[model samples]
Target: MYENMDKEYVLNTYPRNYVNFKQGKNATLFDDKGKDYIDFTSGIGVSSVGHGNARLADALSDQVHNLIHTSNLFLIEPQAKLAKKIAELSGFDVGTFFANSGAEANEGAIKLARMYGEKKFKNKRYKVITLEHSFHGRTITTVKATGQDSFHKSDFSPYPDGFSYNKDINDIYNSIDDETVAVMIELVQGEGGVEPFEKEEVQKLAAFLKSKEILLIVDEVQTGVFRSGEFLATNLYGIEPDIITLAKGLGGGVPIGAVLTIHKDIFEVGDHGSTFGGNFLSTRAGCEVLDILEGYKNSGELDESFIYFESKLQEIAKAYPALFEKVVGLGLMRGLRCFENVDLSTLINRAFDQGVLILKAGRNTLRLLPPLTISKEEIDEGFKRLDNAFKVLS
Candidate 1:
């Protein structure tokens, strides 16, 4: 029916890769035609706990029964509780400003850095250094902050001047003479392809920037909330970033974002605001998701699962060296780097045909963001579909 309806509907937008999806549970999705598929992409890293988690559904439903929303004008209990929990998890004894999406979180982080620069440093530095092959968001300022030149096409010029991109550590050092305020980086550059920066390089840059007293902003939209085997990927680097941006999996399946700062002194009141951010419903969702993840951490079950899952991926990469070049990334956020001249979109379509949903990153990388609750059986099934896809492509 959807295929038929599309015939009459305008195709102004680019064609979608998938034709249909009827329903889903955990790490499986069913199409309108009744084919079942293992879901490896996890809605591009949004469904962290998995599809239709009963706990999340029950929490959301229970909240709807009592209170769905109250304006930010009035103090909300759920929002406060969630904020305290997030602050505790972030290792920051500071306040949080919430938003509805990752872009808003990034925007808020950018604003906070600029304010920190203005108030603390007397506005000596206002430029932000974002790394090349990074993806921020589609908003005007974020698109400009994004380092990919391809994204600059189609009237993205007149961009905010403070944002610039750099390639090497020295290049970044050169970019920050006196005008640079903050250096924002993604531990794992998700949309730019699943490229994890070298640890030594990152540590060197962080040390230099910290000596300069510049704010280090880590974009954890895709790496935070235990998706990378830690609450925040920064914990792995052992570096203390000044500001961090979070979204995607914070609220389980709900829309929520947060801008966290290590020092609360950077902002006075009236520095920023959000209408629907940290309201009753969204904050409740975030609190519940965090609670669930914390339970996993205590049980050590998640750690075991991820260790096994990542090992399996490495084994698969070794088996198919011709097609699967290397498995990049940590924990559940993995990228299967394919050989050159191979089209991952076509390969993903073939996987879908064989009953598995996946996503692509960069040009030749097949990104996999399976739900945290996915079982070993499901992982094996998804890889079977991937193997089939490789066969078809070959």
Candidate 2:
């Protein structure tokens, strides 16, 4: 079916880069004409357990029958279960706030950081320092928080003033004066092309923030939910972040996000709240996703998967050194850097035509965020498609 109807009906801001998706299952999607493509994008890091998982379907169906949205004014069972499970699984001091998306969770974290500063420092600290090239979300405040200045707009004018960015550890340290409330970072910068911070640099900066009594907030919105082999990417570094934000896979195919704080005293009723943050439906999906993670954790399947996946990716990277600058990332959330002057748009389109979906980040980096439940057969098929895409590029 022709999609020109979309041009008449929808807003033109999105750039509609591809055809409309008809249906998806596991790691594949079909278009209107029944053309199928391997979904390496994984809904940009959502869909952890894969598309059309029977368990997630059942959970959502059951919740649809029981309850959907109740005002946060009353207790909800699925929300409580999810909260408890996240706290237990995350090893935090046991505080969780739910939200509908990554940006909302990030907004919650920003508010919590400011509130913590107000309560502990008597309102002396309020600034948050982020790094250059970091991508948080699209909300006004998060857009301001994003390190890329291109996200700022004229009408969005007078962007939030407290957030700042620095290029190096020394600058980041020197920039943090008495008013700095928090330092937020992604251990592996995802949208910035899977740029992993140096362990030594992160350690030094973390130590400085701790010394200044500033909160360390890790934005794991793209790196969390076991996408990087660990439950949270921050765990790999052994740094104790005061606040951690999560989305993108927390509820499998469903939308959900959360902020987990180390201490519970920072937020008071009315200090922060969301109307549809912890709806029964999303919470039920979250609980089922947690159950899936729990099973994978106990059975040692995730460990094996990570081991096999990493080795395979590395092998492919080595084979095509001339075409790629490097392959960098943890586990399934990986990036491929093309040699300078390579047109990534052309390559991505070629991959799509050849039945593989890929994403671009930064300037010359191609990103792959496949579902955790993707099979070896899917990987082989996707790789072959990517190889064909590269052939066109070459």
Candidate lDDT scores, in order, read: 0.85, 0.85
TM-score of each: 0.95, 0.95
Q: Write the per-residue lDDT of candidate 2 for residues 1-394, one digit (tens) a residue.
A: 3457777787788856658788888888888889988998898999888888888999899889989998799998999999998877777666899998999989999999988888888656889999888888899999988888778888888888899998755688788877889998989889887888887888887887888789888999988888877788877777778899999899997888899988788898899888899889988999998898778767877777667767766766777777788888877888888888887888789999999999988857889898887877777888888887776555
Model 1 lDDT tens row, 109-175: 9998888778777556788999888998878888888889888876756778789899745688877
**Candidate 1 Cα errors over 4 Å, as ranges:** 2-14
lDDT computed for candidate 1 = 0.85
* Residue 175, model 1: Cα distance from true site in angstroms: 1.5
